[model samples]
Target: MEPVVLAAGTALVAAMASDAWEAARGALVDLWRKGKPEEAEAVGNELQRARTVALESRRTVDPDAEQALIGFWRMRLDHLLRERPDLARELRGVLEDDLVPTLGAGERDRATTLLGRAEAHDHARIYQAGRDQHIHGG
Candidate 1:
């Protein structure tokens, strides 16, 4: 996934759990309105539904559900980016100036980490801070 698209998608999902969801959602809808006016209403409705799902997951402490929602939005944003390549910068701006700032400290930090890791290759081996060594032959 493109980094900006991943960041924007993650930020969008995180924003759904924030107090500023309405403002964030409005900006998202407006962006879509400018790029593809016909899909604006549908996007708005989907955002609302996503918000409901996000809130429910948060309330229930269902990380899996929230992650699923994130994946759903990631795919949606990926499609949108494919259709309107020029919107990448705009989406990044929304993440930096709007969505991220709206999150609480913990969520903001986590969202940042999520954004950073969004570009990670699935097949690549990852080694964390702790000292550990492994040899693998596949």
Candidate 2:
């Protein structure tokens, strides 16, 4: 659930900076329409507002602002999923079928990809994970 919501939210924000924003917006609104027609209209409007801010963030090269927008949409998606757990598949559709392909090569990279770099010259250690990870040693 968390991964789907995270991917959808990331794709939502990424679409805002893409040339196919309108199409991506349509796909999102359509997804909402399936679960709740009334809320679909509101979602469309909200996407437009977010698009404005997202575009500004891109123009200024503000990663923080971009992350904020992603967080904003993630919350909304989380609530929707909580309300309708069955919508998970549809959410993935909106993410993979619509938003992802529209994104540029850089943005299309799966957000779950994690990279870590460590250099240990002596007796040293490093740890990294794409998600929940725990290390216990002495």
Candidate 3:
């Protein structure tokens, strides 16, 4: 998954739990409307339903449920981007201008961590940790 897409999807879900949700939702729907006109309304409705579910999970203190919602949106956005590569730039704009800024520091941190990854190639060892790590090897 593209890091920006992952970040944006997580941020969008987090934004659903924020006061700026309408704006974030609008931006998303607009993206769909522009890229996939036939699916705009359906996408808009899905966004609303997902937002409701996300909010409910947060209200009930269900972190896992909320994370699941994020994953759902991530897959949806990933598909959308794959189908309409042109929308990737617009998605990035929404993330930078709307979704991310609207989130709190903790939510922002969580969104950032959603894209975490570490890769190693041939003869290249990897020491990976979310926060801190030490590696000892030949």
TM-score of 2: 0.79
Give me the runs in candidate 2 sitting further than 4 Å from their true place.
Answer: 110-138
For model 1, name the residue pairs that clash. Answer: none
Give a tens-digit lDDT track for model 2, residues 38-135.
89999999999999999999899999999999999999999888988899889887887888888777777754242233587778766767679987
lDDT of 1 at 113: 62
lDDT of 1 by residue, 37-59 (tens): 99999999999999999999989
User: Local error of candidate 2 at 70, Å?
Assistant: 0.2
lDDT (C-alpha, whole model) for all candidates: 0.83, 0.85, 0.86
Using all chains and alpha carbons, the TM-scores for the candidates as numbered come to 0.79, 0.79, 0.80
List the candidate numbers ranked by lDDT, top first: 3, 2, 1
Which digits, one per residue and each the tens of the lDDT, describe model 3 over residues 1-138? 888789998899899989988898999999888888899899999999988899899889998988898889889889999999988888888887888889999988877775555688899866657767866674
